[model samples]
Target: MLLKNPQILYALFLLIIPVIVHLFQLRKFKKEQFTNVKFLKKVQLQTRKSSKIKKWLTLLARLLGLACIIFAFAQPYLPETSQSLKKKETVIYLDNSFSMQQKGKNGELLKNAIQSLLTALPEDYHFSLLTNDEIYKNTTKQELAKELQQINYSSNSPNFKTTYIKAKKVFSKHKNTLKKFVAISDFQEQNLKDLEFDAQLENTLIQLQPEKNFNISIDSVFVKDKNIENTTVQVNLSSSTATDQLFTVSLFDHHKLLAKSSVNFDDNTKANTTFSIPTSQDIKGVLAINDNSLQYDNSLYFSLQQNEKINVASISDAKDNFLKKIFNQDEFNLITTQSNQINYNKLSHQNLIILNELKSIPQGLANILSKHLENGGSLSIIPAETINEASYNRLFNALNLSRYQKKQTEELKITNINFSNIVFENVFNKKVRNFDYPKVNSHYYLNTGANQILSYNNGQPFLKQIKQVFLFTAAINKENSNFKQSPLIVPTFYNIAKQSLQLPQLYYVNENNNTIEVKVKLDKDNVIKIKDSSKTFIPLQQHFANKVNLTLQNEPKSAGNYSVIANDKTINLLSFNYNRRESKLNYANLSSYKHIKTQDSITNFFSQEINDNQMNFFWKWFVIFALLFLVIEFLFLKFLK
Candidate 1:
């Protein structure tokens, strides 16, 4: 019972005037001579009783009516008991991810939600809006209308917990302020799961459901097989409903359609279609399918470029026939340099640097190789029969690799391949138990702690890697070991060189941390830029001796084939697509969470919030009371006499 205008209560003092008039107007009952004295006495007593009753009732009603008018002007109200003192603060996280392309009753989920918010919210309504890639703080809906219209499906994938922490920072630190975190999304299962709410803040999860019955998504595209004549590309597809399992998939070379194929998903969630095209020509390809579910996943962009030969540099003056046979001239630019003939400046240009049976390492050569490994090149060390352990250990310490303790005469068979390593992934069809195990007659006892790539039968590592640095304990010379002739030598050495120059893939997911390696020679002043017609920006790049590593954290936000430009020259084409994680129509069950509420849309939530029961104004009820008191006074004055 609080008064809005307590100063209006000063008018209550005016009621004293009516009381003074009632007292002053009261006159002594004048005794009048009448025809009958007894009759006059009886009538006088009755008249006095009736007049006093009517006067007192009229005064009571008049005083009440005046007081009610004053109270009505005061405009008192009862504050909300739920959050009487707390000021509400709303923070909204609108998920503009690729999954929001799904259509609902009105239109696309994102567009419909945006329109509804603009319509429901007032122009001066203030709140913070957070999207996956950008944040708008303490802005009004009128200002947000223009920004919201410009939002596209973002490639930046943000989990719920991470977005929550980022959103919570924009709220006020006052304990008495009530905070509300509203997350509006399609609530895809990959993005939001097991959301634990903060006790101090209120939460709302608004899930926009699509009305469409069926959804088809282009899962991925990869090279199935390739030969001199043709390259076969496999495009994977998936669907939510069985009614539309079969879809026509088209392959395109930029805008020109190359081939068309139909894929039937049947009962399985996954199906693939293949297209054959000439392998000799570089391809800027796109795999497209007609699906109404999500437009972003309907087409996947990819590219293929001409192969570049890997440069291999060997530092040895010994017999080079075995090395020459393994690294042929067709695929490798193999150069053998002696210890004295080494050019330290050009050593980092090679994709792979081989120290082939170096009896003693020069301090300067070891130092250059150390920098080579740091620049993301590959290094393989084949120790000699007798070596300087002290100099080798110095290189080892610089590379953060284990040291060679001492020499061992015990012979060991090189068995056990770490097939799970990224180098051997998909290289082996099945585990081979029986093979000609390479043997080493004498080897150094390499000390502990390295990722063992090829281990001996006794579990001692024959070959191991420490961050692209390959070390073989036993020398692979014809006199010391027969590992030079072993079949394991080809893939073990080739993958090391291939992985060093990580070529751009067929297509990369833009929602992932992808490092695309481009083979180009650029001066220190130059940089690389990836651009299409609509967007152009420089990616985070690190230049080495021969190539540059372009780390695509989040660029080319849309799915398309973009050109890699160096010094205004188009050197290569890199393709990026949105991740297919949002393609599947899976959602989280928000009912399991106790602290948050589930709503259909922000429009409905705003309606409920505007009509809060906490604002109970007493002014209207006071007006009604003033009218009733006036009627009571009228009835008393008119009918009581």
Candidate 2:
């Protein structure tokens, strides 16, 4: 209990005046002689006793009523909290990630949370709001409501630790102040493991859970098979809960339906379907599934652009027949030139440069190869049997590759093949352990600092690659080694040349650090842009002589096919989709934390805050009590006598 104006309580001394008046009896009574002596004596005794009783009762009622009036004037109140000499700060962290599109009891998780916030905040109260992509500070309810209504799903994932630090920065730097942080989200466990709450701050973490946990998502889409006439596209699917349910997958080109298939997700929680399309045409494809649990991962976007031939430059001692057979004319522009007839200007435009059986490297050629690597071109080295080691060593040093050492005539069998490298992706149906082992005779004993793709029986690297450089320790000439006839020769050389171009994939995950190579010539000060039907923006790009390296950093806010435009022409097409990390719907258990208070609803938490900070006055109750005491005094005067 506390008083607003305690100085009014000094009127309590005025109650002593009423007591003195009651005791003095200032009006003296003149007694009249009674008719009979006995009757007068009896009547006088009874009157005196009744008079004393009335005086005492009236004195108590008057003193109590006067005291109640003084107390009412003092205006006492009940304190909800202790006396605060500090300022108050409130901050709200709202999650707008794609997973918040899940449905709860009311509607979508994000929509329901927004409605609760609208009802909880008062008209004049101000607070800071932090979302995945936007921030609003010291904003009123009206302003924040407008921003919330315009909010859309975000591709940026959530991290509670970063959010806590951001909330602290939003608060003013006052030493003596009360700060409260209210976080409302689905509380996915993806980024909550290392979050530590401040003990000095009041923290309320609310988890808006969905009604069900079962969800089906389109895991990925890729080109399973591609020939001259047709391309087979494979779609992978996954489920959160294990159930033998059949789901429908639809393939669309823009709005026209192309194909449909049914997938059965058994207890294994995986399924896949394939669709074949013409390999020659440009396709803006969309793969969609009917899943009501989460809407973001239910569809995938992809693009199939027209094929472009790869430029292969072979600088060899002579025209090798095997090299001619591998790089066909239909898909590869094979340019073969002798060492003396080399075109220095044509080297910069080639995608893959092969230093084929060079007897000795010139300083000029070594400088060119070094520049090619710096511009993101791939190089392969095939050394001669008896070559000038010093010249080749200088080339090796320039390219950061291992140099050939003293030549050995001993034989070593190619035993190990690393299947985990990205160069071997989708190259084999299954890992085959039994194959005709390839052997090399009279090979050089070289040292390397790279990933060993094919190793010898003695665990020595026969073929190793570091970044864009591939090295072979043995000579493939028929007189020296029969490795040219081995089954591993085709994939080993062909894929290395194929991987040199670094072409764009069917689709990329948005908001990730994804870099795609676009093979096009860029004029000076000219730029390319990625765009869809609604929005267009330039990506972070680096230009080489004949290609551009574009790094995506949150430009496409949706999942769809986009065009790569240069000089107002659509040179290439690409697609991007939101990451599927949130599809499993795994949530954190915030109740285990001691410093955090968990709330189920935003309205309930704010209601408790309002109640805790409110002041309840007792002045009205005191006024009512004073009136009651006055009524009791009147009752005594009217009926007790």
Candidate 3:
């Protein structure tokens, strides 16, 4: 028990007033002669005894009730058991991720949390505030209110491990002996997947902001195929509820409505809506879903570059008729040159290069080709019929490619093709059965550490690809093999060129990756800027030989199409959307934590603990006691007489 105002106890001396009144108001006695003196003496003794007993009872009741009233006025309460009054340093982590857009009965979860913190926290208690992407240290009440009002939701959704590490770093700088850690969030289940924390943190607190209604969100948007003129844009939608729902999906091109559709999902929980749009010109668009609860994830922004003509270059010892005929000048910009007459300077602009049956690879040529592959150009290696093994091995060693083994003359057929490879996507309208496979007359055996896309009947790889390099076991010509005449040759060569274009991703999110490589040569001193119609800012970037690595930090904040400008030239269009992790509204099971309070109860609990329950007034109880005791005194005066 503790007293709020011990000085009120001094009022106890007032009890003597009642005692003095009792003493002064006593009845006076006089001696008088009367008949029957013996009966008179007995009556006097009995009456005097009864009067003394009543007076004593009334005095006891008055003193007891008066003491209760005075003690209540002093404002006594039960203090928290622990009396550690060390000056405190409190750290509060407020989740301002996109998922906090969830609405409750009061308002949005983030807004409600700010209001609660402002109302509950005291002026004297200086604390640190941490959001997903920003931090404030030792903030005063005025500063806190200003910062809280400016705090808006962010696209970043940092996991609990990252948040915990950041909190630890911020709190470590403070030298206060008594420290308190408080985290307030919606506690989405994914946030805790990688949670790491010290179990023995002192005075730790967590305030979970729960959601009142369910939510549906647009999970992602991906460009299915960028090789074709008409590409499919697939939009993935998800819901928090177990039952199915109906949602409207809309596709917009620069704020112009391109396509709209309603999805009926009665038995399915997740559904995909795809739109076929032309990629003749650069396409910048947003795939949206009509979800009211969480609008941040309802739309996904994307951009796809226009399809340009592919440049194909072929270097061979002789003019191969099949290679020339396949790479027609009508559709492709083909550059055919003999090994001795090859132009090294023009190779940089070519999308795909075919190295035909060369007598030997020179060190200079090997170095140039290696640079081509590094610059995102695709290379195809076709072994020579009468090859110089030592010379080929030297070039192979220079490029870090696998050396070829002795040639095998066994007649072999390509038995398997990996249809699941992205290169084969949209190649076939229907599954093929009993299809004729291409045969190779002779091929060199190599232990190439690469992905085998086409394999032979004898378990040897006919074709293999690794990164930007491709390998063929044998040469393709009328004299060497009939593979050039096969149906697979046209699409295979076409896809090779398609894959080398270095297609930019439809959209990117900085959940785990913060950097993207753009294939554009720029002056070292030039600054690169990323901008939309509304905002523009310079991004941190690193220049490479033939590409630029741009680091996205607190950028592409909104979902939309953005232009990458260098020296005021619109070089490329880039798109970014909010991280899809926020779409998963599966919340954490707060009951699992031992020391946690819901948003509704945490404020009151903090007051009780910090203020020592002083607001718990008992004066009304004492007032009732004071009135009741006076009634007892009245009863004695009226009846006992």
Give the TM-scores of the predictions, in the order they appear. Answer: 0.81, 0.78, 0.68
List CA RMSD, all candidates: 5.0, 6.8, 9.8
Per-residue CA lDDT of model 1 for 50-140, tens digit only, reads 9989999999998998899899999988876666435778899988987888889998998988888888876756799999889999899
- Candidate 2 on 195-215: residue-level lDDT in tens? 889998889999999999889
Candidate structures ordered by TM-score, highest first: 1, 2, 3
Q: What is the lDDT of residue 120 in candidate 2?
A: 89
Steric clash pairs (candidate 3): none
Q: Per-model C-alpha lDDT, please?
A: 0.83, 0.85, 0.75
Rank order (by lDDT, best first): 2, 1, 3
Say which prediction, candidate 2 or candidate 3, comes out ahead on TM-score.
Answer: 2
lDDT of 3 by residue, 323-394 (tens): 667776644778889888878899877778888888777557888888887766788888877788888888
- The clash numbers for all candidates, in the given order, read 0, 0, 0
With a 3 Å backbone cut-off (N, CA, C), the pairs that clash in candidate 1 are none
Q: Which candidate number has the best TM-score? A: 1
